[model samples]
Target: MPIKTPSELFIHDLSDTYSAEKQMTRSLPRLARAATDPQLAQAFEDHLEETRAQVERIEEIAEALGLKLKRIKCEGMAGLVEETLSMVDQVQEGPVLDAALIGSAQKAEHYEIASYTSLILMAMKLGYAPAVPLLQATLAEEQATDKRLGAMAEASAIEQAEATS
Candidate 1:
């Protein structure tokens, strides 16, 4: 459907994010398995649960707003997940790979952060008061995940990778 109004645009973006969250649910397990660092592996596992909840939150918003989320593929997230998974093949399975995974995960987190931020703003502007809290909750989770990943990278992953080099 052609987006001729702000509400339509909001739905488009929301649907895109829904697709992104679904993609992550599938990709995160691989990431968790590939992570050599215990903390990193656990982080991926934890985020997988969060991503599941986030998907449900989006669905709740859709139901509350009486909008059906489009079954569109979010190409942006597809590319991000592809790149993230490819890191396993590109790098050796160790500290270097762990570091690479952090990088990849952060890229996805940043994408989600931006997407959620825009969605929140759109929700507010479109008078989607019901969606604001749900979007904000997901946004908070994404931001926290990014921060945890960054801390892990700084505290160990990057340093370990460098030590191996």
Candidate 2:
């Protein structure tokens, strides 16, 4: 174990988050393809585009701070992704697939919201407001996606489930 300063901890978290976002860029495509709903697929595509901009923002924060971030494994996200992939295998047809996908994707987005919110607060307290906004920007996107997913789930998913039953 290494004794880490607050700055080091901040940097470590940033690196982990960076890797998580990068991982999503790849994962989102598969999710898009697996989606039974065209809307759901398009949502993933839009998110992937937003995610790329987020990566740039994070990198900008790293450069401004004179810190180099090394990609760290985010097991939580990896597990979430694996679960989603597994769900795809299990739910291959019908509206249930889209419902489940919205559920799984929202779970992932919630995790991201928590992570970025925490990171922003830490950056602010660490006297790094410039980085704070960068984290907040991502946080906002995650929240928006969550809201959008919730709407989709309510409008289409639940109705579909009821119809099938």
Candidate 3:
């Protein structure tokens, strides 16, 4: 699709995020199972629920905007997930893998945060008032997830990984 209007761009971004969240729904459980740290595993599991909600919110936004969800593949997130999957296979089940998992999770969260932030700003600029709050909520959740991963890394994963090495 050629870049034409802000609305067009917004819809594209919306679809992209929707696809990303849907991808996470499948990937998160695997990540959770791969984690050796109890807290980290739980965090991934909790975020899977949040990811589902985010997917629904994006769909709601599409309905509110009178736009159908585009079937756009989020290649960026696919690449990220692939990288994480490779790490899971390469690393032994231990704190090192847990740390790598946190790093991978944080990278995905950061991508989401950036995407949602951009979408919220665009929605506001385009006067899509209804989308603003929905996107904002997801953005906040992504940020919180990132922070939780950071805390997990700082509190245990990183130190344990280093100690074992």
lDDT of each: 0.95, 0.88, 0.94
Write the residue-wise lDDT of candidate 3 on 1-165 in tens digits. 596888888888889999999999999999999998889999999999999999999989989989887898999999999999999999989999999999999999999999999999999999989999999999999999999999999899988999999
**What residue pairs clash in candidate 3, if any at all?**
none
Cα lDDT tens digits for candidate 1, 45-149: 999999999999999999999999999999999999998878898899999999999999999999999999999999998889999999999999999999999
Question: TM-score for every candidate vs. truth?
Answer: 0.99, 0.95, 0.98
Candidate 3 has an lDDT of: 0.94
lDDT of model 2 at residue 49?
99
The whole-model C-alpha lDDT of candidate 1 against the native structure comes to 0.95
Give the range of the ten consecutive residues with the poorest summed lDDT in model 2: 1-10
Cα lDDT tens digits for candidate 2, 1-165: 463798888888888888889889989999899887799899999999999998899999999988899757888889999999899899856688889889999999998888898898889889997898778878999999999999999888878966876
Ranking by lDDT: 1, 3, 2
Q: Which stretches of candidate 1 lie over 4 Å from their true place?
A: none
**Best-to-worst TM-score order:** 1, 3, 2
